[model samples]
Target chain A: MYVAVKGGERAIDNAHAWLAEDRRGDTTVAELSVPQIREQLALAVNRVMAEGSLYDPDLAALAIKQARGDLIEAVFLIRAYRTTLPRFGTSIPVDTARMRVDRRISATFKDLPGGQILGPTFDYTHRLLDFKLAAEGAPLAPTPQAAPDMAPVPHVTALLDRDELIEATPDTGEAPPDLTRQPLELPANRALRLQALARADEGFILSLAYSTQRGYGRTHAFVGELRIGAVAVELEIPELGFAITIGEMTLTECETVNQFKGSRTEPPQFTRGYGLVLGQCERKSIAMSLVDRALRWKELGEDFTGAPAQDEEFVLSHADNVQATGFLEHIKLPHYVDFQAELELVRRLRAEALAQTQPSPRAAAE
Target chain B: MSIMDRQNWMGLLARARPADLAALLPDLPQSQWLRPPEVGAVMVQGRTGGSGAPFHLGEITVTRCSLQLTCGTVGHAHVQGRDRDHAHRAALVDALMQTGAAADLQARILAPLARIETDARAARAGRAQATKVDFFTLVRGEDA
Candidate 1:
């Protein structure tokens, strides 16, 4: 049992003041602004927004600044701030089919409709440090091209669907579980699992996905489609009796086709794993898809080979960094009473063991 | 000017930058709040497998308000972010759009905002188009 003792009020206050001072380090230098972080360190802001499960970039940037560049802390700050606000309503599901395509590519097809457009990607860049960037040199502006016709890019998996080569994504028309409002229950549906993976810690999900690639839970996954773009979010107004676009957000979507043989009642077909996340987060979305596929082993009738990724309970329970960090960091708090009790018990047990092992005083004297 | 549907105009208004919308609105009209500008979040949902069942993706901050002009035109606005003034201005525009000022507002406000948005989108699309891969077959002596 933990007991609360309150004597460090002044110390805590002083520490917080010192933390504020340290957070604004080097008074001679100009402090970093939230807008600069939002624009320049965009990927960092994206990660915080995705994991925090909040879509406000300004708030995310402010959290990053207040957290002094610690991303998980920033995410925690956002999550805490999010709970204080009232939920107006839920938006109609965003239509990714109508997304304004920015970067879209497929490994399965060399050339497909809406040819692979590498939008602001660092894929071909060498890992060597650019000293010019470090020296604050402004590079030449990007060369502009004639704008292409705004045609909707069809999914590569849809082509496979035309031939009935891959399993069709079922339109269940079910309302998905809200993981935020309700406690996570085991044996989650595909929608619930996807929602969890979308906001799951990037590093944690990445490692899990990496393990699957390393033969832990091999799925032989292929990147069928990876697209990043902006999509409009719509909400229905009861008074107006129509849905209206409230805002638009950038989303990175990944669909992976995995090899699956026929089951007793099923036929051999390529299965798919999906990942959708807020902002231009390609790596996280890819990682999420791989892990999502691995976790579906049971539903897919594949042997549960006891891989860490296949354990739904284990994966979902520990996937949240906020929960993990809270428990891990709480150990630093005062455990004096518990420690003292353990110390006394340990002393008594050690004394008893020594007394038993050694000769008694009377026996030794005799 | 082509008249826009209620949905289209509302979306354009919501997506417009606060400063841009404010710059366009130089005149004030007498109005009362039916529902004052309030900041809150709306849980955004996404489909499973991109076309499957709907799932809660996350929450986004949105400010919504409803107001009525002295002429009794009621209007509502829901915009992304925590800008109370933006929401108020959008609501006012919604009210004004129903009156005799619809054509004028369309010319002075909505048209320019829509043009700005279109130009921005075209510029982004142009940059992306430049990166489109163009594949060509390499001719060989064996083929020749």
Candidate 2:
């Protein structure tokens, strides 16, 4: 007879202790500092903040270090930390128009007012590995010039707006419903859906956005403009009588001009899909905008083709990696008790089938 | 004055030098703890192009303190990052501002911070403007 296994608690404790040792991994070289992660591995930190939905660089850095550079795990850490926080108040919407832009580019316009300020981008770099980087002191060719004098750049979409060629966005001061406060329901409003997509896993959103390009819910989109920069945040305090700038944060904004089919009620005009994310997350922002446009098919009077991107419920529900990973990885836990019952039933059924196939012993002897 | 203006001045007061507020209200107010000074996080939300639908950007660490003064004025302060003392000071200033003493507080504390914030913003903008570029195209003779 097999007895139920015990002492799992002690084994689990020992395993965790061993995991801590393994995580350090030959500590002779040097230990990673939070500042090093924050400054050096900044892109990772940005992704963690974007998906984790937490903006603090220091905490994101620490989470990255704790998770051993696993971005999804780092995001999970941030999400767990955020759940414990007390919300004091909501800030006034940040003004991106007043953003001190670092990198601004438009696909539609060649000669924009501000011109193209390609701030630190890898768009033109060759992908070959440099052996010199493995050694000390790699030299780089430098380009020098007098700093260009330019004016404040206007958004490319605004040019379209001048001719009334784009969809109108009205300024309604209605407070958007909070996604965190209530359970998610199907057919989520635009605000709630956007909230879900902003923190959605980048890879998942990217794939869905990619599917749209491959004729799944196809909508031809042109990048109207994409900008990355810092914007000041202001908050309203009733006692003070006016809004005040509290701080500044870096953000990535993407606007997509999509070709929309017009109905009898409206003339054919270019529609827009927008994305705004924390830090310089250009890829996520672009993917988010594409998906954002795909989700708006119903509102724009476009027929739903039953595409993955068009299914808001499916996309929002599965976009969170933490929830997905938990459900997926939970199957590894013990299921022996359930299996044992199935084992007995199968054995009995096999024996019965064997008896049915052959005659009884007395009948066979006769 | 309007709540928006009052909030603006209070934000300045909260972020300004603690010494300035300490000098004005040296003694801490005799108030009961409505919500004790605690460090927490708030999920920051952002809107597309500053005017469209809202989305969750991320959460930031914030220290919040709330208290009720003996005279029935309630004050609250929520500041980014974990600074308990700053939150406490801000909360005290908030409660006092609600009372008739707001005018004194604004003139003494808010003015300096407002100037500091404005100057800092202008300096940043100046540095960014130095790198701005303008592009022009040359005319070609064959275009007839």
The candidate maximizing TM-score is: 1
What alpha-carbon RMSD in Å does predicted model 1 have with respect to the real structure?
1.8
* Fnat for every candidate: 0.76, 0.38
lDDT of 2 by residue, B57-136 (tens): 66667677778999998877766666677778888877888888878877766665677766655554454554444666
Q: lDDT per residue, candidate 1, B1-144, as tens digits?
A: 222388888999999988999899866678999999999999999887788788888888999999999999998999999999899998898888889999999899999999989988888788889889988989988998
Off by over 4 Å in 1: A1-4, A137-139, A263-266, B1-4, B140-144
Best by DockQ: 1
RMSD of each: 1.8, 5.0
What tens-digit string does per-residue lDDT give for candidate 1 at A81-156? Answer: 9999899999999999888888999998998999898888999999889878866657778687756647788888
Question: What value does the lDDT take at residue B75 in candidate 1?
Answer: 88
Give the per-residue Cα lDDT of candidate 1 at A355. Answer: 94
lDDT of each: 0.90, 0.77
